[model samples]
Target chain A: MNETIQHLLNHRSIRKFKPHQLDQETIEILVRSAQAASTSSYQQAYAIVGVEEENLKQQLVEVASGQTYVADNSYFFVFCIDYHKHVLAAELASGSVDQTVETTEALIVGAVDAGLAAQNLVVAAESLGYGTVYIGSLRNDAAKVSELLELPSHVVPLFGVAVGIPDQQPGKKPRLPMDAVFHRNTYTDDDTMRQLLSQYEKETSSYYGERTDGRRTEGWVNQMAASMKDPKRTYLRHFLQEKHLSRD
Target chain B: MNETIQHLLNHRSIRKFKPHQLDQETIEILVRSAQAASTSSYQQAYAIVGVEEENLKQQLVEVASGQTYVADNSYFFVFCIDYHKHVLAAELASGSVDQTVETTEALIVGAVDAGLAAQNLVVAAESLGYGTVYIGSLRNDAAKVSELLELPSHVVPLFGVAVGIPDQQPGKKPRLPMDAVFHRNTYTDDDTMRQLLSQYEKETSSYYGERTDGRRTEGWVNQMAASMKDPKRTYLRHFLQEKHLSRD
Candidate 1:
């Protein structure tokens, strides 16, 4: 019932944004709010690259598989899992840095921290009546995005967020019931999953089919199956390795 | 200036929590708020396992290297990157699921979604006058936590959240200046990083030295250097392989 929880619950990805520029002060506040989120042991293993140049934004639009919002939004920030700075910090504090610091766990910490920071930015933006959407398609060609942003070793662009004033209000998307995702002490039994999923399919089917005026008939499961039938972003492992982020 | 952003900016990880259990309705509302967070392509690739049993909490505390907060918190929930349900959904919609669906991108999606969902839960809990802390140390023995939770294939425990009423108010931790984290069109130059980090080290040194009453002389960089000297959680890559989550 409170405004804070209401803002959290009322979130919807905003794709259509008005052609307005965010003031420098507002953008700075958003970044500060992001930094306020909890970091694992305060390593702060993430960085945000805000792109305002029209040329670079256009290139990123192409790199993100033609997400025009990347070019049109008031601000487009690519959030990267950044450990390169920590490596530099270690070297400055100690004589040398350890190679073992590039373990998978370290990589996980960067990615999770990037996520935590980006989500905070989203909530803060929404609270201020600005709209935001995450650009996961940036990973469609992450290397190009990283190259454009001049990312060094131990840093990789994970996703982008486009923020601006809203031009449209999308209907709230329905999520799976709590029984499906919230388990008690342990994972739910298979029988319970089956029942819950069946109900979910029907609910999703209605949402998609009716909302789009029969333009879409597939339910959540079917759409996911189609998407999963083919491989996606298979180059990620090789890319992570190239960036020295996939140490064994 | 708003309550939502104020709640976010005021966040501090609470280790000392009052011994009080959150009511079931409040917990349900928190989980619902978590589900409301944005997901990539509507793929809700996360699940939360609420652990209230004292015995399981004790075991998790041991798994997390005796972080007594895990055992003492009123509620502890293991947040997981879960694609197992998506795999099942794929199977239900189609006759078979593609093994290629378990690519690193898919894993990243799951991990990022888990982070987004968990942050929402934290904010929601905070809105209701609760304190929250993330336990990344759960990954210190992720395999054991998985085994304890009976997690199936393509599912991994990313972290844990300890939530309860606050027993103490810790000073807000200092973060890197916005100049360091929020870059312009591209990442800032090295000279900028060095200058910013020098300032950061001074701030953090004062914070740590003052907080522990001079008992801990190590600044942020020194502590990070010591922790990074040896490999922590080296078994994660192999653990991912065992869970059938390692695909290129």
Candidate 2:
């Protein structure tokens, strides 16, 4: 396999980082790497804000539900789903586009664009000897992150990713069985999901030795169980509607 | 500065592919590379259906708004925003432990997860000497696509990508200036956007060389206008409701 393929096959997320700060040149390389990612129809329906301020990172930490690594990281960024540019771009064509670009489809496009770009940035950072961790909990409170990032209406903060040099390496997180996902021409599996997850649960439960913290023994199934609990997304629809996204 | 960066920078959606078939090992490598992508919470919240049957490919061509190359490509994979597993996982967890998953967040997570993984697959494919094109119009009638794919509720079709050896090489598709999407610490530069896009709009406008298809002159602005004017999105909410995404 080629280097990029090899990198993709061997994947891991590094949450712990060293105190070393990323230089401006390195930041430029990452941003350029991000920009090189494919956008749907070149609409470029996303934007990112480099977080270099200590106070701002603190506020982001609070907004992201106390993921303190966000504040402690050497380099941080917030990726956004933006349609305001198209609204402005369309303004030059005729009038303000009437349709709300906040449909599930639109959100999917923006989120995917951001997601695709963020992955490219991840590999690029790793290539340069930097560590990375994606912050999906940033979506736990959309409005606060938007306000903290000074995001304009019609541009929502999808997620943030903290980047820095490695201080500690997190072991590879276990995944479900390959057959559970990789269907041939159609999606079919005779094996039960419980069986697949059961094997993973056993593997993960003892994978890491016990820590004082409760997260250690929780294992993969327990983690999935925890994720299943409602996060009170009432703020989400309200935020999207207030931001003028949703259906007309 | 590196060959990978150079390859990334030269990305273009290729519609025409040579009739050569990709080996099963290559498909495994590509999917493995895809699985290696960063998934939110490692939920792996997506599914890909590889298309090999000519009859199924023909139906997909129709679902993708009659893109003939979709059926003609060497490898066709449909990416999905799959929350069915989460729902099932939730059902099991809730029955055993009394918990429920957040549907909207799961949907968003699935799309972003699938999109990121698919992008990695694209890069890996290109690196392995293959051409690719994303079929976004698959959302034209999502319900139809779902029915055709035997997709359960909570599994939305995000997009399809066709991959193969290049029968034709295409030039890079233009993109908006970095300033248009990259903000410093926060989003604040309409002026910066206006300046950069003005030049980019010109580049994209001449992209097709001013052909007779009146749309050839629409440029980015015109395309946005035309998209906004799309009445096909007329019953999008009702469609999602029927699909049980019920974002309402």
Candidate 3:
């Protein structure tokens, strides 16, 4: 990995922010650089709402499930996967169009497009000496977010990104062993899975200073449990369906 | 956009492929570069499977609804929105886990994770002088692809990508005006839509070239109409549901 890939590999979510503000020029440059990232089908099926207003930012924090970083950050942006424009395009081309994707796939794609763009934006920002974090919690209540942002019917909040000058230096997070992620022709859940993860967990726990200091670090599994076992897991689909996405 | 972003900006599906073979080294480099992309929380929630064995590639071609590029190309890879490893991790943590996302937000993250990773792979391959096209048609029969790839339940085939040296330079595809995608505080899909797109369609049609042009050409709207009207256009959600996706 050279500098660019190295930068990506060594990325960390920096939540600590100084009270400094990002200038308009810098914001424009970052978004344009983000705009430069690849979009599927040139459908350009995505949008970025730069959160600026104080009350709106507070509402955004609520939309993001009260993640303080979102409201207080110097540079905050919500990346949305959008098909409203495509709907218009569809209508223009062929009167009324059947929405084949429903809201599921459409909303998923919107979030994905935005996430991909945000990833690129983060890398670019980091290259230019900014700290960043991806706020996936922004989707806790998509309908509310849509209302807050006055989003159109075909748009859904994918995630939020916070960027600014670093307030602190947090080390990079450790990844699982390559085999865990990089698999052969199929998926495997072998006993070797846990063994492969053993070294990674140790490395990760050690990096987090949880190895020597007995902390509740169950490693990847624990994190997965915290994340996946929530009742709200499938909530976005309903919200998406509510928004007329049948991603069928 | 410059040449690099221009290549990204004008991306399209090149279904026809010349009988060819990509050397193992280039293939390795491409996949490795893909692996080098930033993974969320360093979880690396995606995988790239090379369809090298001709029989397997043939099956994938059929699986992609007769998109010949899969079997005929120098290369093909299925990008997956995978949470299988994490699911296993959750099981290990709590001694049991659900096969489906308990939350719609988790689904959103997994989907976006794959997209972010795939876009990186695309950019990396393009930088290495490879021509590429995305195979969303693969999603036309995601379940068939899942069975063909012998994919485990939680890992879904979000899309496929085909890459090779270009036999022909596909023309640039225009995007909606920047304002169309970049909403300031909110989104607007109203009267301004028709007025702006009126002339742009002419530009899009011109780019498709004259009717005598050897290549099949359809303007975006017409292309979308064909896609929406195509029987395959509507099967994805059914495939997902039949695959036992529990979007509670």
- Candidate 3 has a DockQ of 0.41
TM-score of each: 0.97, 0.91, 0.85
Chain B TM-score, one value per candidate, order as shown = 0.96, 0.88, 0.81
What DockQ does every candidate get? Answer: 0.76, 0.52, 0.41
Q: Which has the better lDDT: candidate 2, or candidate 3?
A: 2
As a whole number from 0 to 100, the lDDT of residue B58 in candidate 1 is 94
lDDT of 1 by residue, B63-171 (tens): 9899899989778989998877877887677644447546788778888899999999988898888999999999889988998888888789999999998888899
> Considering every candidate listed, which one attains the maximal lDDT?
1
Best-to-worst ranking by TM-score: 1, 2, 3
lDDT of 1 by residue, A60-129 (tens): 9998788798888889989999877777778778644446546778778888899899989998999999
lDDT of 2 by residue, A121-170 (tens): 87777766677888988888888888877887789887888998778866
What digit string (tens of lDDT, one per residue) describes model 2 on residues B162-222?
A: 9988888777666666677777778866776666667777877887555545556656767
Interface RMSD for model 2 amounts to 2.6
Best by TM-score: 1
Clashing pairs in 2: none
Regions more than 4 Å wrong, model 2: A189-191, A206-219, B94-102, B206-218, B231-234, B246-248
- State in Å the error of residue B247, model 2: 3.1
Which order, best to worst by DockQ?
1, 2, 3
